[model samples]
Target: MDSSRGTRIRRRVTLFLLLLVASSLVGTSRAREAQPLPTAAAGGGSRRAPERHGLSLDFYAKTCPAVDQIVASVTAARYKDFPAAGPAVLRLFHHDCFVEGCDASILIAPTAAGAAASAAPTVERDMEENKNLPQEAFDTVELAKAAVESKCPGVVSCADVLALAARDYVQQAGGPYYPVKKGRKDSKVSLAGKVRGSLPRSNSTVDELLRVFAGKGLGTADLVALSGAHTVGFAHCVHVLGRIYDFRGTRRPDPLMDARLVKALRMSCPSSGGSARVVVPFDVSTPFQFDHAYYANLQARLGLLGSDQALSQDPRTRAMAQELAGNKTRFFQAFVASMDRMGSIRIKKGRKGEIRKVCSQHLLAV
Candidate 1:
């Protein structure tokens, strides 16, 4: 009970906490590395639902009869206020799907109970690739979720809200109107460490991108169509700096880029450093129009990201990009089908996860 005894106890406790934090980080990294990439079907590679859970459009028919209309109205309302809302919502779904399936873990913030039970203290939104996700996207999803909760109470999952919101966003943006399956439960396990590894890098080749999608049963054609989502959004300069400035340590612009396109990019992002915050449309021709212009831009060698250009540069995906650029109807059909596959990536069902009361926080510990 002396002063020295108290001081010693406090120091020991501080050191113990530091060691525990370090150990948890190491454990998370190792576990993420050990985890296998998501895949669909054993060998069939069909666009059917996974064998474990029954995912259907009518999953919420009885519980929330007007679920789709509710989500569509809210999304359209948000889109009217924020023009970029379409791509922002779509990006959330894309990020959620590529990781452990469209389980809505990106919306979950880390919680004491979730960390204690899962031994992971990080959430998916904190990942570097996800840092630039527009604030408009998060706001739109939260608004839609609150609207759904008001009517349906706890019947709908945040995962389904996001998926349905994405579908509505696409239709509002002039893309195809597609059916999205429901009944997905929210996942509590979100690791900041897994996102970078799980996602395809901008500098990745066509082969690497193809492999990333194939793990989820998507083919080369699917990759081309999904990439078409770039049609509506804009990319910040940081994601395009390497390709515009020094690609491959050459101290020159990317050789694959059209000379005039390079000149135009330099105007937006100067050769002099420090414009990483500047923004440019994914397709300069029709940045606001959600259509086949993205593929058309690639044909003109004006792709803003390295991965975008890779689609037209690499022999494997090049032909598909060219074909999609030419045929608007074909592009829409392929995109709808690819979106269906992406939304079904990997999901948790009734007993596997919980319906979140708050989209940004895990369900409170009972």
Candidate 2:
């Protein structure tokens, strides 16, 4: 063959090989994408590790088949009488999980014996961070526990009960209903000291909030999605005082906050001599409903808590905040995924935990 003709033939061969290799790679990529995602049982869909803690959707299938129904009934009754029970129970679950890994330690009450053992004995409930967790939450859990105990006696764990109750309340309040994996045990220890820095504060910056959530293996998206729980909750005036008044001691409201929100907040949360018990709904537009309105409020600078509003202002989380604001269905899906991950943090198994007969008292005390 002539030199030019020979070179042309070589180029054709090289191009053919490259095209073949590219086709193979595309096929593999499509195959991988077509595979079904791992479900909760497989534990492969989430960022967190698989389900190795013995938790399952039907943990009580044979032992106490009616556990879910019982807890749901009690929570629904309480919610009907007091709509606040929904948010109260939801906050209780978050506080419980964050401090001691969803062990229901927050439900433990201080006792004379415990007080005698320490100079100043305090359970998780007495911690400054948990002081505002509302009596309705504790009461709702206790009621559910009592009903469960009557049926299954020692088969149900208070931690599992609280988890189920939290889900029930969230669904009752117009939020997505997600399946809760059970098999969690109540923590034997409930020291108030462990709760000091476990929860995110009202005025926490985005970085501070991110650190707290990250410590539990959650990312920014999870943090923003979980914050949507604020949609159905209320914040005490004290939590928003600084934002509406002298933000960061600027002697003025937070510039990021909308002027209309500032004026409305001032009416409810006065700068001075305001009743400490006064509270305002987290989402002014739809206070009692669990929806994407919380994100929309953040977009509008109407977020009740600094940490919540910071999600919209911060570059890392702003996109997610805006995305969730525009799509309620996406927000619900993200919230469920985050809740599943959060509920699985640092769970206890084997002999590290127990099933409390009464949620408010340890088994030994009972």
Candidate 3:
């Protein structure tokens, strides 16, 4: 062969080998990126090992006794007639966190403007206004916290007390176990109106819900998983009004929803009332329990929100909801898995993020 031709052939071979090596590296890097987090159990899907050890659980348990005591004292001080107010106070945080992730910011921070500073604003509002608030749940945690404080001072936070109370509440109600991750510090800044703006509405279309979830770095699957929280709470008539009224062409309730139920919901929520006359807890049948009843209700067209029923229409989320609906175990496993994923979203970890003393102001805190 001519020397020039031979040289050209050798160069081509070298280029091809280099291309192969580069391809291999790219493949390896992608696999690493896509790998699931490590969980406590082998092959337990993808679970990232928690950074702090049993610290979260220990802190949660340690702080509970004090929180419980405080709750008891506060309820007694405030609502002498309503003796169960303490444990009810604790549910505010649990319901909020379970619906979202354990971002304690929801309890104290306002996600919007002009809203009053209150824990679990949406849920608590209906409860307080209608005198329907489950005071017992709040009383339980407050009493526990008070004891903890008497024993350990302010070492425990209302935030940690909330996590522990939520965990126990679910178990007592025969729901899946929700693990607590500790080391979450408290934020002093609170935003009231912000809650309404930040939360997904019952009338929200699938597109809107997708945007809200994505804004938090979640996807369709996460939205569906998070909606599983509907399994536990209930919606007041006011929440589903837009759906019945068809406001802005965006609040279309599912055709699958029971017409009778829809009519009743509409009638109960008169146009003139300010959260009065009628109430629909997010999960009416089992309002305080974390169970699959929410999904099961959706199957029967009894889903409280248009967004909840809409889950059945989306291809990606439909199967998940169906899987959870078919079996309680499946729902629990998926809920935990999804929560783990949701909790990891957009987290500013390591040197990348700071633990702000307040969540409402900004990531950096003013």
lDDT of 2 at 150: 96
Candidate 3: 10-residue stretch with minimal lDDT? 25-34
**Residue pair clashes in candidate 2:** 97-102
Cα-based lDDT for every prediction: 0.75, 0.79, 0.49
194-216: candidate 2 lDDT, tens digit per residue? 88888999999887886777667
- Per-model TM-score versus the true fold: 0.82, 0.85, 0.59
> Least lDDT summed over 10 consecutive residues: which range in candidate 2?
25-34
lDDT of 3: 0.49
Q: What would the per-residue lDDT of candidate 1 be over residues 18-136, giving only the tens digit for each residue?
A: 44344341111001111221222322344444233668989988999998989888888777666677888998899988888888888775455654657656678878888888777
Candidate 1 local Cα displacement, residue 63, angstroms: 0.9
Better of 1 and 3 by lDDT: 1
lDDT (Cα, 0-100) at 218 in candidate 3: 52
Backbone clashes, each candidate: 0, 1, 62
Candidate 3 or 1, higher TM-score: 1
Which portions of model 3 show Cα errors greater than 4 Å?
1-91, 94-103, 106-141, 192-197, 246-254, 271-277, 283-289, 340-366
For model 3, residues 172-243, the per-residue Cα lDDT tens digits are 445665665554444433333334444565667777776656544556656665677665544456667766
For residue 10, give model 3's deviation from the true position in Å: 83
